[model samples]
Target: MIALPFLKSAPPPLQGERLYLRPPQLSDYKAWATLRAQSRDFLVPWEPLWAVDDLERSAFRHRIRHYDEEAAAGTAYPFFLFRNTDSRLIGGITLGNIRRGVGQNGMIGYWVGEPFAGQGYMYEALRLIIPYAFTKLRLHRLEAACIPSNERSIRLLEKAGFQKEGLLRSYLKINGMWQNHLLFSLIEDDRWR
Candidate 1:
């Protein structure tokens, strides 16, 4: 796989005031499964339909392998968010669909366990990943999309300085149906503004 210069090595764990982000691992299955099970109802509406074996150990192993491949190919960086105080897994974030050359862009996607929602963990995760995407990965723009009805995501994107671009018609098949999504973006030059 061709590697971008900036992604020649796996990213170091990103540290923040209340949490840190690291890649998924085999040892994380139990915590990950428990969290997802608890948050299934909370997350399902905003996500693609989950496979019957989505939380099974074997499926998680496949997910880890896929994450490894995406990272190796410099197409995406996926991280699991963990609280600092007790080292509990709180959520996850990804900078995916990376475009190189003139585009120099990527898409951001995230999810937080229900118990950890509305607590600013996702915001901090964004704070860490945005700079990493801009400086370390040299992305010129970062984009995110969410279902229009997802007020929480809309607020989070705005708070993180992403400007609403427009609506995408049936952009993603979420929850087993094609759903309209609002697109938001933050350019590298917009970071400090």
Candidate 2:
């Protein structure tokens, strides 16, 4: 694949009090799979339908390749969130839709493991990723989309300084159906504006 406009870019490693962001690795498959499976009930309403044996090694290998390709191309960084003390994979997040030049913008997407939820891991992940976007990628804006009913995610984004812009009606087919989202964003200037 051709490189993204921000081809020189790469995801910066980020760390926080309880969480860290790192490139996803093959070793993470088992932990990631188990998290997803265990969180199925907790994640289904926010994600797609459970695919057939998606946790299998073959599928995971494909995903690893995809993550590597996207990260190398600077189109996205499929990162794993880890609990700092034990360095255990607790979730996945990505910075995508990178636009360079004047816009210098990107979007953040993430999912936290069920057991890790409500413990502020997602919030810490956002805290780390947003700064990485602004400083390392030199991004001017960062965006996030969350289902209106996803109170936890909404709170996390808001806590990270993203302001709700508006609602996108039936904007995406999440969980196999059209879903509305509350669009939120933070601009670089907003940091000190």
Candidate 3:
């Protein structure tokens, strides 16, 4: 059995030039809900089935608690992306399903608000998270999967140095249905050299 790593505390916020990545907090419910509501149509196709009360404040609080627990257990690290200047919640990113023994790997997932899409915000966030995953989390490989048609996401991952690995048939349920995804990966040794 794989033993979970432990972290004494939550990771500190990752700061960037124009954006910052931090775990969701109780105080962020309003902004998170608002952005999600507005971007529902834009984001649904790439995500899982949303619960009826997914945007409710109570639900968000529950999510925060769950994320905190996951982080402390070193099973996952989830972050909300925000604009540094105005502190607006723009999107979210997560490094999940961490495996440490043989693989030392984790998977990454992310989404941007409709208005924030195509503006390079997510790319900058990736730059921050990649290093943290390798240097701080000590992960050796980072993987990402996106629907084959998500050209924008493919481009972003490529820009961030993830190589297209292959196609995953019926890999995940997206928008309530099974979907194929293109796999991409980056290794720690290839990160800086």
Candidate 4:
């Protein structure tokens, strides 16, 4: 078996013309909860639920613990995407479910603030994250799965150069129901070698 390399506590914060992606923190709680809760309807179809607990600082503290552990183990990078120039936490994007060794891959997941949707922020976050995953973390592939009807998400992945590999039937349980997702991925060294 290949020995696991020590993981970085955090990836260097990423920047773009308008946005930056950084590790989550307790200070981000209020903004994160507000945005996510306000976007409940928009996010519900895509996510599980807006647990009352998810809106609490105590819950966020627990979440940060899990996030920090995942970071140390090199298994995940759950980022809060912000608009740097404005200092606004617009949404979240996570490089989750990472696997090392011969696979060297991770999955991408994200959501944009309700009001911030259609402004290309999700695209910007994805653009920054894909390269970060493949180049900095040396991951071999970046994968994303979207509900076939989630046009915005599918569009973002395609714009970032992920190709559809297949459709999974009842691949994941979302909002308490088994749902389908169209799987997409980009192999490293293919576009950014």
Alpha carbon lDDT of residue 29, candidate 2? 84
Output the number of the TM-score-best candidate: 1
User: Judged by TM-score relative to the true structure, which candidate is superior, 1 or 4?
Assistant: 1
**Clash number by candidate, in order:** 0, 0, 0, 0
Best by lDDT: 1
Clashes of 1: 0
**Per-residue CA lDDT of candidate 3, range 118-140, in tens?**
99999999999999999888899
lDDT, each prediction = 0.94, 0.83, 0.92, 0.87
Q: In candidate 1, how many Å is residue 130 off? A: 0.3
| Model 4: colliding residue pairs | none
Alpha carbon deviation, residue 159, candidate 4 (Å):
0.8
Which prediction has more favorable TM-score, 2 or 4?
Answer: 4
26-115, model 2: which lDDT tens digit per residue? Answer: 888889888888898899899877679788988998988988888776778778999889988899899988876667799889998889
Alpha-carbon RMSD, each predicted model = 1.6, 2.7, 2.0, 1.6
Ranking, lDDT, top scorer first: 1, 3, 4, 2
Ranking by TM-score: 1, 3, 4, 2
- Kindly list the per-residue Cα lDDT of model 4 for residues 38-117, writing each as its tens digit: 88888889997557677788988999999998998889999998997788999988999998877889999998989999
lDDT of 3: 0.92
Cand. 2 Cα-lDDT: 0.83
